[model samples]
Target: MVIADLLGVAKVAAITLNERGRISHWDDTATELFGVAPPRALGRPPAALLRLPREHRGAFEPGGFGHVWCGACTLPRVDDGEPAEVGWWVYPIGGTPGERGVSVLALAADLRRLRRDGIGITIGDLLLAPPDRPAGDAAPARRPAAARLLRVEPALTEPSGDGADTFAA
Candidate 1:
């Protein structure tokens, strides 16, 4: 299926930002996922709507690197409901950061759904799952320094059914 169709069914919401970081494209999945309408979602900084914390801004926010940024964050409920854990992937469009840097962001409201469907959302060595792979299969090992800070291991995200981590801390 095309990416648009994929986003619609994958429990993953995607948004696009214009050069100035203003909301540009908020897809149907995003509207339902965030509970925000186009009028409210557009022209606003994502941090304001997504409830990203200031302390972790460096990791969650896009930067000059143009690399895909992925992280796990608890998002505030739009209607004062229970918060939810959302996995986010932010990719910068331009080669360098500046006043004009468009980006496409994908947020996974249900990582397990993606994992169950055999997809691993990744950044550096953070997440290693590939599309449609069996969740029980072993993912590769490439430990990034950030992995330590994130306290992430393959087994932490994907259990081998025995409840033991493949790579122990």
Candidate 2:
């Protein structure tokens, strides 16, 4: 559905953030969802408008921002009514992080309706949080130092028609 929305097969609210993480483009759909027109939304960080949690606050930092998919997050409406749960995707464009002219495209959809449609969508669907640990403890299950430096690529080869798949790297 996210892919469909991005391809124009479906419609969703869209916002674009500049390299410095200030709003650059705000679409009508965005105004409908957030209840803030482009005049008030532009030139401001999303955190200043949305009720973003601490973890998601990094989305406004160019140094830490990356391609992120937030399956469900609550954002307060402009009228201060019940919060709206929505799913969003953030993707950088033009250049990589720290590069000039880089901008981010954010697409958001209402999760309540998504659930009503029996889509079975869940929060943190695409995000994998690091395992929690007790205080002052090293992370568990870390790869060996040597393994961290290793690079592996699958070898491409023609199928031999043996009714089995083969991969070598």
Candidate 3:
């Protein structure tokens, strides 16, 4: 069983697709996220499950590179409940030569809490992509509007060795 399946939570989902865009793995989290069980989603086109927009669907094609896209939007469900507004990230996921596949990793949290408190966590230098196209076709694809690169540094300061020092000096 995958990590999501073992956890049995609906907060995160993971899916892998091949050159043909067929589903390779669909864990429990994915089932809850998309509302489609593995038996039904497996072997099906990624578009069928996600129903991505036409322009965005092309980006999911296997082996296609040079762009990163993301959005903070809501996902609609047919069940008798309100739609879910989520923060999502999407990008190409392969580095092997001649390999063609894209992996989409998504994490969803309560929107209310986010709106009230903002993201309290500190994020380091992030490599954000420009909104416009790069100068030349050879130029690396621009980062998506929502993309942010965070550089995290470990907190290494320790308490002073002095007997009474309770904080780092």
TM-score of each: 0.52, 0.57, 0.49
> Local distance difference test, per candidate?
0.56, 0.59, 0.48
lDDT of 3 by residue, 1-169 (tens): 1111111111335566655667776777566655678888877776776655466565555556435556655555424344655555555565542343435333334354345434322112221222232434343332322333232322344534676534323
lDDT value for candidate 3? Answer: 0.48
Local error of candidate 3 at 24, Å?
1.1
Model 2 residue-pair collision total: 0
| Model 2 regions more than 4 Å off | 1-9, 94-102, 117-169
Worst 10 residues of 2 by lDDT: 1-10
Per-residue accuracy of model 1 over 7-114 as CA lDDT, tens digit each: 112346767776556777777667766677788888787777767766545443445345667777676657565566667776666545334445545444555455
Q: Write the candidate numbers in order of decreasing TM-score.
A: 2, 1, 3
Query: Model 3 compared with the native: what TM-score?
Result: 0.49
For candidate 2, what is the TM-score? Answer: 0.57
| Candidate with better lDDT, 2 vs 3 | 2
Model 3 spans > 4 angstroms off = 1-10, 78-82, 95-152, 155-169
